[model samples]
Target: MPSCQPLNRMKKVLTAQAEAEKIRRIGEAEAGSIEAIGKAEAEKMRLKAEAYQHYGEAAKTALVLEALPKIAGKVAAPLAQTSEIVILSRDGSRVTGEVNRLLAELPVSVNALTGVDLMKIPFLQKMTNPQA
Candidate 1:
């Protein structure tokens, strides 16, 4: 053989260089994909916010009414997952009281979160004071 050693070394160097180039290309493709996904998500959020801004008070009230049950479901989800609830007191009334308090707090929490006073709404006002 003329010089098989030099040929083998050169082949190894070429293979390593090709692998490095492939890795760099893959990294750049992944970065581009990530950037595109981020931009898409940002655009979606912007459009959603714009749509929300277009909603009238009546639509917003309807939206809140629809959301109330979902919010209650979320609040009650933890209890659903639990096998049993332990009451430290002699009677289980404490637990019932707490549950009642949580239900009572929902409207206050919703008002604080949405800036819509649930009490002032005409529908709720009529429901609360039906004679009026």
Candidate 2:
């Protein structure tokens, strides 16, 4: 009866220890999840702030410039699949003209995407600053 009493106490102690460890691990997991959520929220706010900072025609132009490569790639993608390209005009004017025609749509595309026209964006005056 004395040995049984000691064994019961030991079993109770081990169970309590296991419960404590389980609670500690749960707390750590919750803390990590909270921290991760906070970081994501902060990143979202930072991006919104950055966007606010760039709210102008110049910024719009810069954005258009950045997207130009992607736009060009998309516009020219069909040509990529062509096994061979044949030039009908010996002077290559046909190809150049076609490219120019494609590029002419860029301003309209930019306006559609950004709600602003790139061509209408005022350029900085150098030689003719009337204030100067």
Candidate No. with top lDDT: 1
* Backbone clash numbers for all candidates listed: 0, 0
Q: State residue 28's C-alpha deviation in candidate 2, in Å.
A: 6.4
lDDT of 1 by residue, 36-88 (tens): 99999999999989998999887888888888889879988999989987668
Model 1: lowest-lDDT 10 consecutive positions: 123-132
Can you write out model 2's per-residue Cα lDDT over 58-107, one digit (the tens) per residue?
A: 77677777887898799889999899976677778888989988767767
Residue 65 lDDT (model 2): 76
lDDT value, residue 77 of candidate 2 = 94
The 0-to-1 C-alpha lDDT of every candidate, in the order given, reads 0.87, 0.79
Model 1 stretches with alpha carbons more than 4 Å out: 86-101
